[model samples]
Target chain A: MSEDKNDSFLSRLKAAERRSGLKTEDDTKESADDKDGQSLATLALRAGTEMISALIVGVCIGWGLDKWLHTRAIFLIIFALLGGGAGVLNVWRLVKPPPV
Target chain B: MAGGSSIDVLGQFELHSVFGGLGDALHFSQSPVYMMLAVVLVLAFLYFGMRPAAVVPGRFQAAAEVCYEFIRNMAIDTIGPEGASFFPFIFTLFFFILAGNYLGLLPFSYTFTSHIAVTFALAMMVFVLTVVVSLKVQGIRFFAHFMPAGASLALAPLLIPIEILSFLSRPVSLSIRLFANMVAGHVMFEIFASFVIMLAGFGVVGDVFAIGPIAINVALVALELLVGVLQAYVFAILTCIYLREAVAH
Candidate 1:
C-alpha cells in the first residue's frame, strides 16, 4: 500500500511537470536567461525613476523649508543641488553589481 | 455625428457615488466598489484554487501552487534567507495590484490603482514598513546607511542631505511608476476604443476604417495583459529589495 502511494505520487509529479511545458533542462536554462534579461530591464527602469523622484523630493523639501524660514532662495538652491546628487547616488547604488 | 462629438477620453476617470443612499452618505464611488470586487476575486481565486489540496493536485490546485511557488521563489531569490518571513506581505501586494489592474480591463469596472491617491497610499505603506523594519533590525545603525562607507568627512554637508533626499524619494518613485503606467495604458485603450465607435457611426466606409482601431485595441489588450503582470512583478521585487536592504547587515 505504501509502495502504491509512493508510485502514484511520483507519477503525478512527472505528469504535472510535463504538463507545465518545461520538459527539458535546456528549457529551464533558457527561462533562467530570460529572467536575467528581465531583471536587467527592471533595474534600469527603477534606476531612472529613483533618480528623478529623489531630485523632486529634495527640491520640494528645500522649497518648503525656505518658504517657512522666509530665507528666499538659499534653501531651495542648496536642496536642489543636494537632491540632484542624491538622485545620482541612488542610481549608482541601484545598478552597482553586488559585492562578492 | 457632429464635430462636437470629440472623444471624452479623460471623462472616463470621473467618479460618481454608488449604492444609492449609503454611497451618497459615505461619498463612496465605483472605485471602492471595484476595489472590493478585486479583493473578493483574489480571495476567491486563492481559496477555490487551493480547496482540493490533493497530493496528485487537480488543475486549480496546481495553479494555486504555481502562484505560491512563483512568489516564494521571488522573495527568496531577491531577499536571501530572510525572505520567508515577508512572503505573505509580498504575495498579497503582488496579487492585489494585479487583480486591480485586470479587473479594470473589464467593461464598466474602475481601476483604483490608476489613481495617484491609491497608489501613493500603497507606496507609503511599503515605505513605512521598510523604515520600521530597518529600525527594528538595525537599531541606530540604520542612520549609518545614509553615509556611504568610504565618503570623506569634508563632503558630509553636501553628501548627507543628498542621501537623505534620495532615501526619502523611494515611495514617490514607486507610487508614480505604478500610477503612471496604469493611467497611460487605460487612456490609450479608451482612446482607441472610442475611435472605433466614432468611425463606425459613418456607415460602411467608416466601418471598414473601424477595423484598424479594433485591431489596435486587441493588440493593446494583449500588451496590457503583459504589462499588468510585469508591473506587479516589479512592485513585488522592489519591495523585496527594500526589505532586503532593511534587514541587511
Candidate 2:
C-alpha cells in the first residue's frame, strides 16, 4: 500500500513538472540564483555575520579617528560598546516572530 | 519638492545657510529633509512600479515582484515555516533603506543614513521586534538563549556574560554597519566631488584634470548602490535568524 501511494505521488509531481516543460539542474540553479530569492535561515546567518562585521568596524573606526585627532581611545571604546549593544539587541530581535 | 525648500538637506548640499535654532545656533545637518524626500521617492517608485497589473509583467512590476519574492524567500528559508508571516516588514525595510541610500547618491542630496542616529534607530526597531517576537513565542525560554548547549555547569558563569553581551550587541552592529558604509562612501564621493569642482574652477587645465576624481566618483556611486541593497537584505535576514532561534529554541 505504501509503495503504491509513493508511486502515485511521484506520478502527480512528474505530471505537474511536465507542464512546466523544463526539469533540469540548470532550472533549479536559475531559481536559486533569482535576485530576490534567498532562504530565511541563510539570510539569518548572513545577517549575523554582517552584524559582527559592522560592529567591529564601527568601533575600530572610532578608535582610529580618536587616535588621529589625539582623543585617545575614548570615542573608540564608547562607540564600540554602543555598537556592540546594538548588535546583541539585533540578535535578540531575530528571535521574535514577525507579523503575518 | 526639495529644490525650492526653505533650507533643507538639499540646501546643505548647496552650502546655503541653515536655520538658526533657539538662541543663535546654526544647525548644519541636512539629514532630515533629504531623509523625508527619500521616503517620498521610495513610495512614488513603488506606486509606479506596481500600479499596472499585467499577466505578463512589465520590467518595473517584475522588479517589484522580485524584491517581494526575495524577502519572502529569505524569511522562509531562515526561520522555517514559522517565519513566512514577517515578509511584509522585511520587504518594506529592504526597499525603504535601499531607496534612501540610492536617493542620497543623487546630485545635491544629503544622506540621512550616513548618520549614526538614523541608522541606530532603524537597527533598534529591528532589535525591539526581535525581543518582542521571541518573548511572545518562547515566553521565558527566551532567556535560555544564552545557556550554551552541552557546556559544563562550572563554566556557565564566564560563558553567560559573554553570550549575553554578544546578544545585546546586535542593534549596534546592525546600525553601525549601514551608517559606516554610507558615511564612508559619501565622504569619499564628497571629497572627490570637491576635488573635481576645485580643479575645474582653476579653468582650462583644471577642466582637463577633473577626469580623475570624476572617474573615481562614478565607480564609487556604483559600489554605493550595491551596498545599499545588500545592507537592507542583511538587516532583514538577521531579523529572521533571531526569530528562528526564538521559535526553535
Which candidate's DockQ is highest?
Answer: 1
Q: Specify the highest-TM-score model's number.
A: 1
Worst ten in a row by lDDT for model 2 chain B: B1-10
lDDT of 2 by residue, A12-50 (tens): 898878778766667777887774354564456545754
**TM-score for each predicted model, relative to the true structure:** 0.85, 0.65
**In terms of TM-score, how similar is model 2 to the real structure?**
0.65
Clashing pairs in 1: none
Relative to the unseen true structure, what is the C-alpha lDDT of residue B144 in candidate 1, on a scale of 0 to 100?
Answer: 94
**Cα lDDT, model 1, residue B163:** 76
Specify the poorest-scoring 10-residue window by lDDT in model 1 chain B.
B1-10
lDDT of 2 at B190: 64
Q: Give per-candidate clash totals.
A: 0, 33
Off by over 4 Å in 1: A1-45, A97-100, B1-5, B201-203
| All candidates: DockQ | 0.67, 0.11
